[model samples]
Target: MLKHFNAKSLFGMSFLVIFVLLSSGCDIIPGRHMRDQAKFEPLEASSLFGNERASQNLPENTVPRGEWYDIESNEALYTGMQDGEAVENIPIAVDRDVILRGQERFNIYCSPCHGRVGDGQGMIVQRGMKQPNSFHSEQVRSQPDGYYFNVMTNGFGVMYSYASRVNPEDRWAIVAYIRALQFSQNAPLDVLTEEDLEQIESVVE
Candidate 1:
């Protein structure tokens, strides 16, 4: 029994030694001191930068990190602005896949207010919210693509911005889908091909 007790005591002592070493090992760890070096906290006053501020101004031409994309360059892709004006186009490729993605995103985020057909008669409006302008209206149909992006990003009268909820690319996708909805309701019969006319006739019949 004494031998067993001694064994346990030795094991406890070894564990205590290990615990002390690990708990205080930060002082011996290289670079940890530098990482946690006592420096001025942000906005604290100091004479280091000649302005009596610890925060030195960033160097000139300091490009932001991950700025290779057009989004970071004040391009039409992210800000929907070009030459100080709202651009009239989508900066990305417009294709079936993009349109489909737009449709999915629009159905999720916009259909609640704009309706599936873009008629501003969604369930939310039916439930007593103010109805928004229909996208098929001539005013909206004539608007530049960037207008939609801006609205989605910054919101409009009686509408909250979707910027927090929708990413920039998805916001453009939703704009494309909105254009599709506008075309769907405003397609001129005079421009319909013979095959398309026949298809419509069959549906009518």
Candidate 2:
């Protein structure tokens, strides 16, 4: 049997059904069905925003904004010199206090690769890692203070720069300790006489 229906009631029911369908597709409502969609893609130019070519357009050697040298002053930052000129002719004096500090810092920072004694037989080497040359090596001994400084600043071969890890003064201190280690290893026998050895034995007793 067909029941008589009001036109207004039919129109209202149709509106309600359409609203329900739209509401069900919305992601905001829990358990609503939504088609899996990819995120909106960025414009083509946006991908190149940080590329090197963009950086090249900027001024040359201009220190980036908010970045600065860690040194105390501009003079301390870099001594302007090319290759051979970098080596200081003045003797590099050993500061006992600096050497002691360097020894402590070296034990913490360098001992893993370069041993506490600077012999390069660190634990890493004991575990089969590549061995670094000893500080006592002739090649190393021949290196000037500036050479050590440069190596610490720039690094060599597989070793990375220690400039970031250690400060200039501290780097110099490490050089002093390295010299001390070298001196101990290559000291003349005459420096340790029989009387000196007897005095040492007396102290042990």
Candidate 3:
């Protein structure tokens, strides 16, 4: 009887140990480690969904979190467009300081492709890159100020977008500087003041 009781007790202890070991690794129960949980990774294909793609498109009109938004609801301010057309002028006021800021940004960003004078003769072009159109060209000058902003934000032919590197405000500033560069190369003689002419004559002398 004593031997039979001992055997029975040993069997009970072995069963309890096995039960705990099995339950510890099982994730179905609450509070178990889920190190190998099922999930989809980027670009991973899946037949579970009808589209057979792991990624889904974001809903329209919903901006992602941590993104900048225009609080005043001025769509043109951010998009450089109004009523399906590029705006004709800068949305913000332009002053001497604004132009100066634009010059700094232009030299850093635009001068690499478009030369320091907007003449499409930067060092990159000298090294066998395609030459960009001069800002002083009649065709280019005819484009509205916002057109330049749009080009920078969305990129033109052979040019990558600067929208990530440059904010909308700075894009507008660069546009203003481009206009200044164009005027510097093509200013009308009638617009020259007497003092300006004197300086020109002095340089000529």
Model 1 Cα lDDT, one tens digit per residue, 1-205: 5667787799998999889979886877777865698888989999776789998889999887742455557578887877768889898888988899999999999999889999999999999999998998888899899989999988899899998888888888888898888878888999899999999999999
Sequence-dependent TM-score of model 3: 0.67
Tell me model 1's lDDT, rounded to 2 decimals: 0.87
On residues 1-205, what C-alpha lDDT tens digit does candidate 3 reach at each position?
A: 5767687788998999989878777765765558657888988898977999898777789766754867359878888889889999999988899999999999999898898999999999999889998999999999988899899989988899999888888999998889899999899999999999999999999
Q: What clash pairs does model 2 have?
A: none
**CA-lDDT, candidates in order:** 0.87, 0.71, 0.88
Candidate scoring better on TM-score of 2 and 3: 3
Q: Higher-TM-score candidate among 1 and 2?
A: 1
Give the least accurate 10-residue stretch of model 1, judged by summed lDDT.
66-75
Model 2: per-residue lDDT, tens digit, 1-205? 1365678778998999988877766775665535545333433233355662333355688676532454434332332124445555213345678889878878877889889888899998899878999888998888776777777788878888887788766777777777778888887767898997798689999
Which is the leading candidate under TM-score?
Answer: 3
Clashes of 3: 0
Segments of candidate 2 deviating more than 4 angstroms: 1-83, 86-94, 190-205
